[model samples]
Target: MDETIAEALRIAEESFIASSGPGGQNVNKVATAVQLRLNVFALRLSPPVFGRLKTLAGTRMTSKGEIVLTARNYRTQEANRDDARGRMIQLLEAAHKEPKLRKKSRVNRIGKEKRIKAKKNRGTIKAGRGKVDW
Candidate 1:
């Protein structure tokens, strides 16, 4: 993960933009929000890892296979930059892990019987709500 992050950082492009939200006059004057863009193709991830990363990135992943992350939670540019880089690292790490295969579960015979019994009871109750004869 550390090596992946180092490679990512080496190819990442960072830009600073003015942040929006509570920060008094500083928000208007200073550009603290950091936008980090990294080309996922350059990472040379496997097809499976790339698929996972694609799903994880959602709209953040561009058609060009670049992942863009924005961090403005902090007031300082350096802090925001670190936050963006950290998020990117987290994404890469998560992609590296393989998802566990799900085991199919079946309802026990007793549980199925109970469910069918309750369904029959519900049907009976509904059948009782008939219109009255004149």
Candidate 2:
């Protein structure tokens, strides 16, 4: 296992529950859905990373700083568990990356002049559509 995933799993709590969906009678009998709760504080992320994670997680994150992820797409417990863990790791990795800074841009003088010229041309074309006087 990768270091990041192992670290994430170390602080994660996993629970299996009866999953709803197309699994025939097996769905009711077997608990296939995996609910993964990861402790955000355990990850020891920087302030910026934590903020980014909070934004990225949205409602999935609890007030106590735990990220909750449920996976029921897979029919088996193992698959669902893996899916949940993978998603949590992916989220953490994404938060670790810094967002690209945006640079302000200004249109050149010639570009602005061309835009104004186009508007005038369009206005003239529309004006030509008016009813002609007898």
lDDT of 2 by residue, 48-115 (tens): 98999999999999999999999999889999998998899888888888999999999999999999
> Which lDDT tens digits does candidate 1 get at residues 31-130?
9999999999998988999999999999999999999999989889998998998899899999989999999999999999999999999999999999
lDDT of 1: 0.93
Instruction: Judging by lDDT against the true structure, name the best candidate.
Output: 1
The deviation in Å at residue 42 for candidate 1 is 0.2
Measured with C-alpha atoms, the lDDT of residue 132 in candidate 2 is: 92
- For residue 38, model 2's alpha carbon misses the true position, in angstroms, by 0.5
Residue 126: error of model 2 in Å? 1.3
**Which parts of model 2 are misplaced by more than 4 Å?**
1-5, 132-134
- Candidate 1 matches the true fold with a TM-score of 0.78
**What is residue 109's positional error in candidate 2, in angstroms?**
1.4
